[model samples]
Target: QRQAMANNSRPTPTMAPNNSLRWERCSMDIDHLSLHCRQHSHTVLTEATPVPQWIDDRVSLTQVLEAMQASPMHVLDTEFERVRTFWPKLALVQVALPARNVLIDPLAFADLGDLGRVLGNGRPWLMHSASEDLVALKPLTEHAPTALFDTQIAAALLGLGSSLAYQKLVQSELGVSLAKSETRSDWLQRPLSAEQIDYAADDVIHLQALCDRLGDRLDRLGRMDWLWQDGQRQIAAGYELLPSANPHHEFRAAYKLPLAAQVRLVAVLEWRERTARSTDRPRSWVLDNATAIDIAQNPPRSGPELLGKLANCRAFPRRQVGEVIDLLASAEAGAPFQPAPAPLDRETENALRQAREQIDALAAALALESSTLCSRRLLEARARLGTWPPDCTRWRQQLLEPLVQATLGASSPTQNP
Candidate 1:
């Protein structure tokens, strides 16, 4: 224990650890978690190094910063509520060092720039299913971590399931089963119960251990670079606040539509996206995708017909009807119609299946998942065009290029259906 500092109304500054990095978990008074929990004031006294250190004020936050400065790498996780807002409400931020775990209450403390700096400092962060957490990181620290070691992605690349739960990953890798009782609790509420705190702490508490195990497996398999590249891709995706193109353009229905209908769907979907952000509501509340499809396909010219179709959708506000009707009426007039190619015939299906079989055989030879080798969607598209493998990462292309060329080169007329 070292450093004498102010013992303000909130919990006093945790005893800053020496360079040895001996972090400890300590109890804090719950009544002082700011004015948000002023109504539910209570005194809590405990002595357990395993319990997370509750940080809700400036002094405690400063101490955490000091600890992070000593240790470049840390485990991180967040509890956020996204049901009611366009951006997630960052409720609690859990950060873990080898010897200590601390929960930072964003609602209580205002300045987290220090914590944000540590996150963005280009050090490796241990995380699980980090896409959503990266989004949640911004409002708290103002920046997402630069480097990541995502356990979920690493597990998938190493032949574990593509999408694995945090608890299951921990259990499989470390043989520890975590409790899920607080799975649906309102994280924004205060003061959080002891059980809630324990559960939140557990999310990050075991993550570092899993990262170590997964990293070892990937190292032995010599896919560490692959994991790093994939993690970077995941981080880049998290940075995209909106769709890369008109959101409707990604839908299967949009592709099946005539070019002019596709154009109209694009316009309405963009409108819905903008309205959803402005109103801070779900996309469905602004306009459902099914309704957008109907509007594009039918191209209702009259206001009565438009109203009749959308009449059942109460959330389709009447105030916006005039603009929507006018837009729908004129949607096809200027746009040129380009017909989509016919659906794949039985012969094309057979070709695609053969191409897929070749890829699967290659993937098995390399001891990798077929999906990991290349997505089925890309394979199917490329088979139609006689391009075996679609564009991919340089490392991935290097692995699949020879096999893909051989597969396409070997398909003779005799193999045709």
Candidate 2:
């Protein structure tokens, strides 16, 4: 009986009219939400949604390409895995156009270049948080957002929240709560659960509504350009070395300057990045910041030299030390490509902090998780870029950056907030 209750204790009317699943009577209160999560934690995992027969192998790449080619650019999201692996396994793909919705089964047909075109050269898309989705798509295609608008960016612009999840954004924006049951499901599973499929599709279902609300808010405030800037920033951040780009490419070239310091900063960061790749671990795990900086400051040309002063050397194999030295030498010999520099200004910095507060407060007012919508780092990057947040990063621009810009005189006031 207890087991049955546990299994059956899910949201009633298990599926929504839109075929998406939702949680029942979820509390909006922060404490209550946390308590409820800790209690019935099984469901609150990941976007484990259902996969309809239409999305099977029969769902040809031709059909997808035809749709993508015909439709105005669309908003997309994806889920993947990166646990002790060289490549992040593609899990699910959520595509949201103005009038239609799609949930692609990556296990069925992973590649989408013939279908999905990214890179800021196409129609605008309304992605939520683009970083994860972008990284996941790297193994599949060179999908850089052509034209982008992150809903999370928009939410920030509206001062709704810093960073919010699609579910939380939907609830706050449309008063519709989503289920958390599949928040951590094994997305690679073949026969996905009915509940899981619903959860996955739900990630992009309300994106159109999200875009409508955020677009209007951005326009009303005359901060549409903020959307473009956010998109560009996301693209700059979204660039991931192809699985083959350099197995050891630091997850990105982020530790270049202000983030890292010195002339050999890029070389040191790249060395650590390649080391992480060869080991198939995160850059942070391979070499912590302080040690990386120290080693970078004084490069070791020989394996013995590298293993000499480094503290984490013991953590790695001695044989790997030689390879590490080689990589370090190579990096030192060549320069890493730097993305357009992120500018710094006192006003934008202050704006970033104030917008973070404003967005957090607004999220509380709407009963949403601020982190799900936007983040301080993303906001800071946006401000530094001195551009409007785009819409393609899963409403991130709407929910956070616009409001931040409004405070910074980077954007005008909107009617919504």
Candidate 3:
């Protein structure tokens, strides 16, 4: 049974300057299981004091899991590397429970399915800017947490500023300055440096207190529900593993291409996405965007021409040149291209402008960024489709639906065409 921490009124500990805290030995017991701190030395465990522990072995992981299972909420963060891969390489998993901060080594364990199961249990997870972290964690967790309280989302709802960096949020909420010196360190390297460990530990050390402050502010503003709804949306978007269905839409220059070339561009983009995912490589590594566009506009007739086009591109499969040539040939012989929806006409543009003004006024009244309440893209999409974006949250729809209807009308029959 998950139990909420009854007392959240703990003092926020002063962060060690420059993230240079030295470790001493300390020990504690949970349900009579002796647990020792791997990094920090604290004589007495308090709710405010973060006891950093390294979970490198199954035994340690079991202890950490037990502690985590008992907590109602956890402050979670991840350090990952994805410089050249489509998928994030999860380097470290940092989790903060009331008095314990854990640095779980994903490299040490081959499988973390058990850990993932506990994490996905109905209890809430406190995270800051959770989207990327959630993506990095999907390999282990397989799904988002049942409940998530993203500190960044909470901060935004309280008008603390949208997209606040973890360091800046910590500084703003707890008056603590954290160092970012080891941000670029190679987390896959064994025997992590003391500085790196310190940096990693500091990532989650203050999250509990930060979540408390932000959650309280959101509660007082009557926007906590908004934060939760946005958190769920963020989680869903983050964990969406498949490539976008309309990958061609991302290429702004594709619109200038002829209908046939545009169709080729769509096929090439889809192929690139699938290739990147299958090979665990980046889309650029498979085929760069500029090259993809060029090939679509002026496809090679033979293998040598294709080879010349891809000569400068590294990591692309030389053997796949024939395949790409064949693919382009098939696209040329495929059915006629269907043109995309036309750009907004002057009348629709005016309606979109009016909708923006009303949304801006509502955002100002709620002490939110206008874009945060409803982005211009979403507003424009509404004008084009004559319906609200399906992804708009309940709170946002409740506030903006009537205003949008008034400004843009209930529906526009000719808007989409």
User: In lDDT terms, which candidate is top?
Assistant: 3
Error of 3 at 354 (Å): 2.0
Q: Could you give candidate 1's per-residue lDDT for residues 1-417 as a string of tens digits?
A: 001111111221221223122212122222211100011122222223355778887988888878877775667889999876666778989988646788888888666777888777655667889888888887545555555678888888888877788888877765666779998899999878766776787788666555555666676677766776666666666765645354553575466787778778867877777777777666776677788889988877776777787744555666787788777666653334343345678876766677678778977876778898778766554555554322344456555555555444432111100
Off by over 4 Å in 2: 1-54, 58-61, 97-100, 110-112, 117-121, 240-268, 277-280, 290-318, 323-417
Best by TM-score: 3
- Alpha-carbon deviation at 209 in model 2, angstroms: 0.8
On lDDT, who's better, 2 or 3? 3
Quality of model 2 by C-alpha lDDT: 0.56
Candidate 2's TM-score: 0.58
Clash totals, every prediction: 0, 81, 0
Q: Write the per-residue lDDT of candidate 2 for residues 298-354, one digit (tens) a residue.
A: 667777777776665333556677776665555533355443253456765676678
